[model samples]
Target: MLLMNEKIKASEVALTGLRGEDLGIVGREEALAMAREAKVDLVCTSLLSSPPPCKLVARGAAKQTDAQEKKAERIQGGAVKTKELRLTAHIEEHDYETKLRQAEKLLTSGHAVQLTVKLAGAKEGERAKALIDRMLKELAPHGTRETGIQVSGKQAAVKVNPA
Candidate 1:
């Protein structure tokens, strides 16, 4: 529900005294004016609130200061959870590499990834196992296979960790 570059609801912005506060009931022009004065982005903090609004503060500075704390919380809480990569039956080498890069990004973000290799129709035999083995080897340097690769109903799932 929290979208980047989108306005947040009024009820969600926290009051930070004079430094920063929620722009409850403030229009776009007023927000821009406040930002012009404070020299910060009018970012919306809480989205799930009535009459979606924004918070007036410098997002770059705030994020830089709190990045570590936020990362720590994500590492502890599994809420920022696993990301998945879906592989098709006829994936090309370049496509595979692209998917791998995306998987790496997910892993770097401290997210567990489920690489799903799906097979259908004619391409459902020896080729599938070979592809799965290759993918598993690629994943070996990153995470140990806590639960070995599972293949069921023409799909194999590889769970990997952050390298």
Candidate 2:
């Protein structure tokens, strides 16, 4: 959680200016006054540090920066990539083979695969599930089924992870 502007209650804070310059430790009131003068917000960044580190940020930029940092972390943190493949219940054999190859390639490259089979009618649900089961069987060597067939109103889905 972030405490901004007047919501910050620490008596003193280690401040950093808006331009990323260190402003050193200062009184909380002084930091708030500087933020007010600069027409920005006083945000407490690290409440656990000595004097509680604070920084000057434009209104709403704190959350934006946090989101950007999280996105960067996710990209750099070896997050697993999930690829979705959509199919129809009555797919052609050639198309099925193509999709199977694509899935196998994805699994070989350490990506998770979500297989979705769309049903044209209520009666097609069983066929879609059977198709997924057959695909899972064929993909057993390349990947392991992470989830059983999940049938919603008009779609059946399954998840597979690399072996």
Candidate 3:
């Protein structure tokens, strides 16, 4: 946080900055006086330096910028949520279609879809792969595949995102 004018704690601060006037390292009292004369705030930009780095900027500008950034994040979904759907090795056609619709809805709502099928026996791998492939094919109109089938141990998974 940047302190304004009298609120500055450092006795002396490195006032030299790339964007503002070069006051170099000066007493806090003098910096406060300079900020008053310039009608700006004496802000402590860095507290880690030996004398601390301070800058002069218009009051409330930093807070306004921070608020704007937060607003933008809220507008953009901050972070995408991953929706996982697990399928059985032998799902009926109707049940598979229902699951596909659910995955499509998730993608359209700006969420990533994770479809997984776990095989208990080696012979069940083909069936799992087939189910994964069919899901991808049906979901093509609603989303794009972000990841192809990824197999680890006996589980195979895929990822999709809204188009």
Q: Mark the regions of model 1 whose C-alpha exceeds 4 Å error after superposition.
A: 1-74, 122-125
Query: Could you give candidate 1's per-residue lDDT for residues 1-163 as a string of tens digits?
Result: 3322334323333333235443346555655556668767655545555544455556575466457676677677765466788997678999988887787677767778888888786456456667767876876665444466677777877677654
Q: Which consecutive 10 residues in model 3 have the weakest lDDT in total? A: 66-75
Clash count list over all predictions: 3, 0, 0
Residue 73's lDDT within candidate 2 is 66
Residue runs of model 2 more than 4 Å from their true location after superposition: 1-77
Q: Who is ahead in lDDT, 1 or 3? A: 3
Best by TM-score: 2
lDDT of model number 2 = 0.91
Q: For residues 109-129, could you state the per-residue lDDT of candidate 2 as single tens digits?
A: 778899999988999999999
Q: What residue pairs clash in candidate 3, if any at all? A: none
Worst 10 residues of 2 by lDDT: 67-76
What are the Cα lDDT values of the candidates? Answer: 0.63, 0.91, 0.79
TM-score of each: 0.48, 0.53, 0.51
Q: Report the backbone clash tally of model 2.
A: 0
Q: How much is the lDDT of residue 72 in candidate 1?
A: 70
